[model samples]
Target: MTKNITTTDFSAVKAADKAQSYLFDNFCELLTRVFMALEEEEWATQAAWDIAFGPSVSDADAAWRLVAFQAETVTAVQPLSVDDLLLHRMAGLMSRAVSATGIDALETVRSRAMHCIAQAPMATAAAVRDMAKEALSTIDQMLEHALVCDGDDMSVRALPLAA
Candidate 1:
């Protein structure tokens, strides 16, 4: 099992000053918890939101606000990491979960993630480390598939194939 993720630095570094892969890893970690909550059925009911985020401050409305604050943190990074599809998907799911009136949207996102996990290479023995490794490798593969305007822009191109 992974250590407490709340201890990890969740800061949003500037795009040019940070590595994309690093940001991707952090996003993966956060979503992993959200998906686990869903997969375990803790997020299947209305009361689960407060429990997933934290205890309520006096009332349920306070709990919802706290959850919204956490969701905002994830959504704020979308524009900064615009190139990553998975990141956007996770962020959107999180945003919906926080604002959603019913559990249907959350369940749909959970189902989608479960489907991906079922098809993943490590589906049989899918440890967190294995999933993290796969996430990193996927980023590398995305690099290989990136579109480049020209070979002159070295920043975006993958390794050239041998002649």
Candidate 2:
């Protein structure tokens, strides 16, 4: 015999799907902001400095900040001798910041964006676009999985009562 579903079950599933969609939308916005920030070399360099070391706290801090900020930003994804000390360090610092924020989805997108930036001498507009597209696609897949789970729950709730 075929089983039947109910409306209550469907409603629950719909609610869960909505929640997942909301999360994905927020994640996408964060990715967009990061992409815009990296579009210009000056902005990217400033971000790198901020990530590496927080705002200067003292007189000595200002000198260190100047040195680090003056260092060249690595454009290539692969490491160069100079990159090993600077860009790689910046990547690690930014990754740590993302992790500390406890937003796994945003962190993942940031990591991917950083990877693309690290590969080239300064991130190109095309590469940024590609990374943004990929990040948005991944968010969609995550939302789909949440929606499927919601649908399954709805089916369970819709079952007929035994008499």
Q: Each candidate: what lDDT?
A: 0.41, 0.36
lDDT of 2 at 28: 39
Candidate 2 lDDT, 1-163, residue by residue in tens = 9988764558866766564444334333444433332233224233554345543322223332332232212212333233232334443333333223233443454565455445544433453344434544433333333334246532221110000
lDDT of the structure predicted as candidate 1: 0.41
> What 10-residue stretch in candidate 2 is worst by lDDT?
154-163
Per-candidate clashes come to 0, 11
Model 1 pairs in collision: none
